[model samples]
Target: MLKLGVLASGRGSNLQSIIDAVEAGELSVEIEVVISDNEDAQALERAAKHQIEAQYVGPEDYNNNQDFEQAIIDDLERNDVELVILAGFMKLMSPYFIEHYQGRIMNIHPSLLPAFKGLHAQQQALDYGVKVSGCTVHFVDQGMDTGPIILQAAVPVKEDDTEESLANRILEEEHRIYPAAIKLYAEGKLEIEDGRVRIAK
Candidate 1:
């Protein structure tokens, strides 16, 4: 079984989805640990429910970004984590961390990616007046949301759509596609080829 580690902030709704997938045998993987930057993050509660180890490495305690990411790398090594999944980790990783983990790290972004790369993707979509917005799961690279895409689920941007409504819809897709990507990775069905993800039969 693949040993998976999750890094998240806030309420970890996507973290809960991974836990649920593992519990239901939908994903053939073991959750080694869950780490959060926020000490009071509700993701810790979700980890507790699964009886997995949860850690909070606060920003105040770290002298630099490297120090913070090194703590995460150390935790992954200790737990023998083969894959590091970023459910909602908001921190921008440095080149050191990116090079160390390379393709080992994965992240789920709120927008179609290669489009609105950063925060408040829903707002970006609304402001741009796009007819469609989506979510993407991809490897974490040096640039912000510039990694090769592994999975995407599109949601229509309705004429009456507000940021909140659009986000809710995208979130629903997030809950679906992220777990599916995890399942594919666990089964070794995802192969990075020519800068694109090829799903095997």
Candidate 2:
């Protein structure tokens, strides 16, 4: 089975979705551990509920960004983690971490991506007055959310939609596609080529 290490900083709803998929036999992988930077993050609770190993690696414990990421990297290595999924990890990864993992890390963004690339993406879509917004699953790279897309699911914006409402809708899609993207990786179907992702048939 593919071994995964998940990083999150919030409620971990998406992490729950991934756990649900594994239990349902939809994804053939194991979540070796869930690591969070925030000690009080509900993601830790979610991991406990699943009986998965959960860790809190606070930035305060480390001297710098590299050391902080190194702490996480060490934990992941100890767990034999094969894939790193960023469910809601708010901290930006250091270049050292990115280079070490390279294409092994993935993230799900709450925008179509290449569109609202950074934080508050749903609000960006709403502020731009767009009719459609969506979620994107992609490999994690050095840039903000500029990674090559793996899958996208769009949600139409309503006239009365608020950021919370739109984000709720996009989150549903995030739960769906993130597991599917990880399934693809576990099946050895994803290939990176020239800043893009190719799914082998």
Candidate 3:
């Protein structure tokens, strides 16, 4: 089974989905640890509920960003994590960290990607008056949300949709596709060719 180390900064709804999938026997993976930059992140609480090892690695405890990232890396390595999942981790990873886990990290973003690449993606889509909006699961590269796409699910933009409404719908798709993407990785059914992801038979 694939061993995952998850990093999150907030409510951890996505983490909950993964836990649910694992407990339901729908995903063949082990959440080895949950680490959060925020001390009060509800993700830790969720991890505790599931009896998974959870830790808080605040950046303030380190002298520099590199050191902070190294602390995270040490924790991940200690747990023998094969894959790292960013479940709404608010900070942008430094190149030092990205290089260490190249092609071994995954993140879910709320947008079609290559469209609204950075934060508040739902608001960006609504502000642009797009007819369609969705979420993307992708490999985590050095650039912000510029990684090769693994999976995406589209949601039609309703005429009266607010940012919150659109985000809620997009999050549903996020919960669905993120785990599916992880499953693909776990099954060795994902391949990267050129600059894109190619699913295997």
User: Candidate 1 residues 1-201, lDDT tens each?
Assistant: 899999998899999988888888788899999999988899999999889999998878989888888999999899999999998888888999889888888899989988998999889999999999999999888899998899999999999999999999999999999989988888888888777889999
TM-score of candidate 2 relative to the true fold? 0.99
lDDT of each: 0.90, 0.95, 0.96
The order of the candidates by lDDT, greatest first, is 3, 2, 1
Which residue runs does candidate 3 get wrong by more than 4 Å?
none
State candidate 1's TM-score.
Answer: 0.97
How many angstroms is residue 46 displaced in model 2 relative to the true structure, after the best TM-score fit?
A: 0.4
Model 1: number of clashes?
0
Write the residue-wise lDDT of candidate 2 on 1-201 in tens digits.
999999999999999999999999999999999999999999999999999999999999989888899999999999999999999999989789989999999999999989998899999999999999999999989999988889999999999999999999999999999999999999999999999999998
What RMSD does each model have against the real structure? 1.0, 0.6, 0.5
The sequence of per-residue lDDT tens digits that candidate 3 reaches over residues 97-133 is 9999999999999999889999899999999999999
Candidate 3 lDDT (Cα, whole model)?
A: 0.96
- Identify the runs in model 1 with alpha carbons over 4 angstroms from their true place: none
Indicate whether candidate 1 or candidate 2 has the larger TM-score: 2
In terms of lDDT, model 1 sits at: 0.90
Clashing pairs in 1: none
